[model samples]
Target: MTKKTKSLVVVMAVTAMMLAACSGNGNNNGEQATAKPEATGNTNGNAGADKQEEPVTIKVLAQFGRADLTENEKAFFQKVNEALNIDFQLVIPPSSGYAEQLQLTLISGDVPDVVFFPSEQDEMFINAVRDGAVIPINSYLENSENLKNYSYEHSWEALKTMRDDNIYGVPRTSITRNDGFMVRKDWLDKLSIEIPADNEVTLDQFNEILRAFTFDDPDQDGKQDTYGVGSYVDANKVLLPVLVSELGHYGWQKSTDGSYPFMLPEYDAQSDVYKNILLYTQKLYAEGILDPDSPLNDSAAASERFKQGVTGVIRGFAGHVNAQEKVLKEIDPQAELTYLFVKGPEGKVQGTGYGTGIWGVWAVTAESEHPEKAIQAFDYMLSEEGWDYLYNGIEGVDYKLVNNEKVYNPDISRGIATSIMRRHNAPEFFLDPTKFTKEELDRVSPWVDKAVATVVTSMDKGYVPPAAREPQYMDYKLTWDELTTKIMLGDLPIDQLDKARADWYKNGGEQYLKEMNEYIQSLEN
Candidate 1:
């Protein structure tokens, strides 16, 4: 064997040994085995006793957002056992350390029966498939009605693109919705600026409003303390709202040619979209229209500034408007917020679209003795009975139904109850009108309904190519972020963007683009 193959074998052996040493009876948590009722025999005089089949035990390695499951979650699992006749042995590590733990578990050569992958493009997931650790679920999916029906079509397409046109995972679905800018309607009225009809504004009109909010003293405070907009860097370290607007889409831009079918809008050779984004941000910063501390601010801080009435506009989900307005009204009772959807250069309203509408995926491992049963457990979660338990929690314990309305128990905490899996096929799945009174719905539905109705979903929302995870590619991204931030803050000239673009190609971007396009072509085929 070659030296590389020998080395890999040795590493695998060591990982297996380590995993064996760490694992004890395959239960990560010190919970007891799930309880089952005794099977009753026939009371009549029968020749033989009736035997009941034992519940299949499926070991699951999932990531929980919190430290551990709550009592309610444990109860939920019991309900699953009663209905599906399956025992779920869940091994959830801390979410912060889950990625590393997952890598270790996969390399150990003794994987869980069912594993949750946060991203379909996760390197370990791809490697596991290449090594035959994970099995394709296309055949099983054909029979799983709830799983197929509840999940988005794009989610299946995304999974097919991951490797060899095979569906390997059941998607944990999320609502496909876009957030836009929310401005203070009271401030607009105060400035005598007429609110745009249909809550839509042209880019020029939007800029004019920003200038007015900044210089015209819309808040009517004697001092020049207010700014036009609150801004902050997203997880990727890019300034948001403006970035989303300037790019006209999220992630990759679909290309016309077969050779380069998908292009990162920021790195497009033919367009200045990215450069213009930086220039516009710099102008906002120089003119004192954007929050001065934006670079150092996170989402929470920016949102807090908006609530404190320090900024007139902030980016937010439509559902959050009611809460934000409540907070703002505490300071100024007249404060009112409304959603704003601006027309992009193409003369259509644009917002960042979440790709495939999947938050995570659940894959049955090849090591599973009952792969079909494992998938059945997931399908059960999407069923009306299971989803009701997941979404609303135990009917009596978490909430009570009175006059066909759910009145939640104030003491119970079901924070992110559906973290393990979600089923958000429609806006109602997210907003859940049943949970709100008519007055509450009246306050929220206008903004949320409009946001959903007018949203222009991106062409490519959740396509993460394998090349995107490479070390060299990651380094280039960091450099790009740093350069973009510097230019926007005027620490570096806008011309430095050229250098950043050139550095991207030199640092494996050319290869990244080639691989991404190839994958896109594969999806087309």
Candidate 2:
């Protein structure tokens, strides 16, 4: 069978077994476990509430971004063993197929004692809760003051429930900032163009700049080879900064009456908002201002193309500015880069980003023989001392405080230190505050303030898809991708969006709207 077919088969087989396997396990139901003694007797930290004679070994399903563990990871785990007095047997699976793998493993009664999900909102996490694969840890968390203080209240609130008003997991905090655009400041200066203020590019100016970048040989190379913009995986991510400035938030337009414009049939063709965005995209594609390989390019390829001076402006996060600058300097020492927070029609820069909430959560599993001990171990890791170790590694070895500033050790490889730091699967939430200090920020990218300001000013506009209509959302996503790709490629006329909308509704949009609207109502009630 084909790979896709095999994945579907695996999912189906596991799902069928889940209901039967989960129902018999009373421990998996969101219930508080019986009081148990601690594995470590160490109350100095949040290791355990009670006392124990021996160390506890817990199997953990870690949702790692990459498949393999490095030497740094091994060293980090050794430290974890020493600090927490807990042995962790981690099940590391390739992140791409983790959801399917997790389901299959759980259904087969081979689930680990604990599982670290990439996101609390992930469909697999919800299913795991509903299917009784994981137990809620509300009682256990109540025992730890450190875990409570370190956790973001918003993240805790957002991730606690799975339709039963019970806590299922411990959420990691994260910062959400919508992606921004970066351009070569030196190129703008060379062309005698005034740099637009942070997040303040008018459509007219934006187009003009692209034309200059495309035709003016901004790189000072004799050949007119550079494009205005390079490759991006999705149109929404790269173009939303420009579009949301003129129009409101893309995709669903929420009204004051709690209605969604995209869901209503009247706005399907009448609004023409989606069509207009496409037309603009097509214009750039035809004019050779957009990267020709955009439809096929990944973020890495896009960044590489940008570094090679193949494009002048690309959409990315604040960190991309630092990474791109580092590489671009190697190629052309004189190259200078600046980040832009594209302004809306009203001259206000709106940013859509995540707050202090991560996609991953640490959860104790129903099958765990030592559930309370598992919670204690996780809580300990979130303690101040534990967090310090997880975030920086051995103070003088991996990193050190220089003049009261936490600086990475010059001798240690950055890659190794980073790998070690992420060994515990506790994701860093805010990139600026968690990773970058003020002095480091000033040295790395001074324009980050503009982006940060934009993000802070427009925090209310950030959007995440509703989880109520997840299945329908997936179906609609597939249809939307096919429809948008065809329109952008000129294979289908822009006017065909009306037909596309009808197809979407038939596919899943109608049910998605119904379910999402119902969910919104439920939240209000």
Candidate 3:
């Protein structure tokens, strides 16, 4: 292999080996991105090159991207203050009011230095760019000395997406694409179990495995202390969980071969896929695998179960396993956790975030002291060094580079993320793919490979119509959150699922699909 190739391999190997050592930082916010960077990523007295002069307090607007800062974040930032000379007066708003609040603030003509958004409000931002509501970040990419050396992957898609004159705000791509990873590896070890080497298993066999984990005394507690399987989130968060537990068990997409066509049961305002999934969920509850109280449990309670060791087998995507394993180690220290990915019918499972192949497209208002300065700042965010610090956190504190790539310390620092979900608002997480590094890719490769391998062996995963996801179509999805878990986790019989599906179709389901097909066709046009 080439030296570059060999070096990449070593970096990945080191990260994989040390994954257990680095439990991981949990975001105070509910979700988004891979992992936020720690404030002062200073390791071994070197945080890469020196930063430029620190400016006065920059009034920055941090959209409600994360929950809040932990004590660790504060400590790291305190250290940062020692070196840098700027106060990042962050403006964090609630998710519900993020766009509205931003608009209100802008109308008052009092915008922050940095304008952040989680999911892009493309329409408003586009108009803002036209009206000069945002400061362009082009110059920053070239001039900002502090951010010029930032490392990590920053895809072109992200870079281009966050621009108007093709020059706009900085894009801090969140790491949300990695999902459907990790299972109870420690449990597997305790049971002296070996995973299905093939990665592909029929729904029935997958069910049996979950039952084995839940029913069998793998832990040897004697009593029927384990559940066959479990689910999380009152609604959609739990979808991926079931997908993980059962692997190729029950799903809407069908096939024994070829690509799983995106078959979202044509949202027949009469036969919607959303309700169909819900009905099957109810069946899972009837079978005694799903947690009934999942709907009522707050984020803290739900996450605590996995962290404290009450739930042995659980599933989530992206950083879920990494973070969970970290908590497990702290709880018991020797906790052995594994993320055995699930397979679909067509056997094409992947443990990355659903591809949002779009640029972030941040705009600047015409009214600003340094419109070019704003663009320059954003450009810095997109630079190699800017992304490196953002992705890896303040250098030595978070990682050290033996090779050209980043080698994390398991304790990768993300000073941006807070400790509590509702306490402080974090606005910097805007996920764009261009910012990923080969090291990051290598680090998560094994689990992702397993996911793909599972798909290879599974039947098929037909595409679910994207219409059910569009804003207009989503409005029709009545079986959301609380109601969804209530029905799915209850003792609903499997036989009634068909009628429920039909009922959903009658309730705005068909319109959802019509809108979807129209939208899809328009894209082609």
Which structure among the candidates has the greatest TM-score? 1
Q: Point out where model 2 deviates above 4 Å.
A: 1-53, 65-111, 118-127, 143-162, 172-174, 196-200, 233-246, 250-253, 256-273, 353-358, 380-384, 401-407, 411-440, 443-480, 489-494
TM per candidate comes to 0.80, 0.71, 0.57
Point out the worst 10-residue segment of candidate 1 by lDDT. 41-50
Lowest lDDT block of 10, candidate 2: 26-35
lDDT of 2 by residue, 128-181 (tens): 888888898777777866667755555655565565567888765454444567
Candidate number with greatest lDDT: 1
For each candidate, the alpha-carbon lDDT, in order, equals 0.72, 0.60, 0.45
Candidate 3, position 202, lDDT: 53
State how far residue 206 of model 2 sits from its true place (Å): 3.0
Segments in model 1 whose C-alpha atoms lie over 4 Å from true places: 1-52, 65-79, 96-111, 160-162, 235-237, 241-243, 246-251, 256-261, 329-334, 354-356, 392-394, 413-417, 432-437, 449-461, 464-475, 491-503
Q: What value of lDDT does candidate 3 attain over all alpha carbons?
A: 0.45
